[model samples]
Target: MTTRYIDAGVNLTSSQFDDARDDIVMRAKQAGVDNMLLIGTNTQDSMHCLQLARHYGFVCTSGIHPHDAKSTQADYIAQLKTLFLHPEVVAVGECGLDFNRNFSPRSEQISVLSQQLELAEQNNLPVYLHERDAFDAMRAQLEQVKVHGVLHCFTGDKHALDFYLHYGLMIGITGWVCDERRGAQLQQLVPLIPDDRLLIETDAPYLLPRTLKPKPKSRRNEPAFVEAIVREVARLRGQSCEHVAKISHANFQRLFITRRGTQ
Candidate 1:
């Protein structure tokens, strides 16, 4: 069987990322993932992501993770602009708000998110947003910009899901969906996500699924593990994994790879 997979959210800067390319890609092949969208949590991470993508011929995104929001500055945007110049850097963020941690002050989060949104707008780059326990604040921030991307690693309930649906934003689901305890809700809820608006990811170096057989020694996640997410989503939706793959592949193409080189 032929598999065309997109590991939509992964960390190329992780220690695991230093594993040789052939080893990394081989493991991904084991999980049936052929394509990857590596996440860059900062300017440095994003550069490494783009460079690795070029080397591996994998798709990638320039991710400015919400955790770094406090330190985000004008120079950050300048650095991001340079990263976006690479065709492999398909999106402008992993950027958004996370009230759950409150690691960064709300003001700093708002300021940085605002600047990143404007950066996405001005550069015409698609966005990859991250939100946790701050749905209302995130929605308010998004209200000011036209979105051209997804709310990645989505874990919200129906209302939050519906709000993004109205905004015409796509979603990227991760291994968190397979958690029998916390993810039980998603088992029912994920199917509600329209086919066109759905996609799958690993969020590697994080969110490892329990179903994984003989877990890694350190238990760090990787792109190869994304198949567990895809399979679990299919089970929840009562559809074949192949069907899920086809639709998500189409969604990825639509969102990141423009048709006929046009938007």
Candidate 2:
């Protein structure tokens, strides 16, 4: 029997998908990934993601990623509110700090993230969070705001993982767990995520699972490969793939769909 899975995150609007969108979704369905949440990094892409979600019958988020913080307009929050009003745009982020790259200045990243958190609270929407080498700063902001959602594509140490878990966020595991190298820390942290708080994502067009057999020539990840992430997470946590898939799907619904009164 095949386990129906939901990819908690996917960047379907990326140019890599171009004209292959329909085929990508079909392949994901065939691979047992029956649903996916397309990510929105900025306002434009958030709108695009919502369109794709509605057209393809998936869910999506609306917010500005910290990397794009510098490009924010004065009415960004208002824009996000408008997007959030759409049934298809279920969360308020892909918004958080990323000191690792610091594409946007640290101050700008923090300011923008705080604004998004305020929007999430005001709109009563869950958030789709991200953080990299900025747990201290992210934790500080989280201390001031209370919201629900998944910490997408998590790749932090147990210390950071424990904090997020305690703070009431679902942990989103990705292909990083399949890496035999840098994924070592994340692999060790996997078993600690409670089943109810676990989620899975491909972060597709990125982080292709190293364990995937007959890897794609383009090396660009897609929603169809999320099953590989599920299998690896299952193995690392000593759980059955079906069990992991089922729970992750349930968790996604609890966080995104059920709250909105639909699946």
Candidate 3:
């Protein structure tokens, strides 16, 4: 039998993904996916994320995107915490710092990240981190946070990978693995991440694996394409597709189970 999978990271706020609950669930169900984690990019997106998950019986995780770090505030943190109390709201981030875009000020980014990290710590929830071109600073902030979570779409080097794993963080690989141009290191690092500490996602509507179905009009990504990511992992690890399916599913469950009570 095909193993049930998980669409571990999806930005569901795009109009393309709006009102897509039934379609998303059906596609995942057809793919033997047991659950999907709809990641939110901000406060409004977070609430929409929860409503969608609860309405569709899917699991969800939400927080501010690092690019929006400058927008973070005390009231926002409090509001996010209130949302965290909801049964389907698992995990406290998509939070962390993003220097690649630096759409926001760096000092503000650090301040907001520190505050959000504290919220995750206090809430006793795992985080869904997003880091880009700021691994060292991100690592520093992460080190200070006691809560655990995934380094989503990890593009770091060996030292960074080892550091995250050592600190009890999982590695979330996305469709980038299928992009030879941007993901060469990931191809080499996939096998290095322990089976129990690795997960896959489409980070949909963004990093569509060139191998997946008909491309969406606006670079919109769907849940089904996650299969390509799984396939890449299978090839990189020299494991059968079924084995990759089972192991990754298990790893995903183990990591998220701690937050199951929230949902």
Give the per-residue lDDT digits (tens) of candidate 3, residues 45-147.
8998998888778767778887777666558877797897787887877887888888988888888778878988877888888888888898788878687
| TM-score ranking from best candidate downward | 2, 1, 3
TM-score of 3: 0.93
lDDT of 1 by residue, 1-263 (tens): 87667787787668765765567678887767767787777888888888888988876777567788776656888898888777788887878898999888988888888888898887777888999999999999989988679899999989999999999899999999989999887777898998999989888888998877878886888888777888899999898888888888889888887721463
TM-scores, one per candidate: 0.94, 0.98, 0.93
| The best candidate in terms of TM-score | 2
Where does candidate 1 have its weakest 10-residue lDDT segment?
A: 254-263
**Candidate 2 lowest-lDDT run of ten:** 254-263
What's the distance in Å from true for residue 236, model 1? 0.6
What lDDT score goes with residue 61 in model 1? 76
Best prediction by lDDT: 2
Better of 1 and 3 by lDDT: 1
Off by over 4 Å in 2: none
| Candidate 1 stretches greater than 4 Å from native | 19-22, 259-263
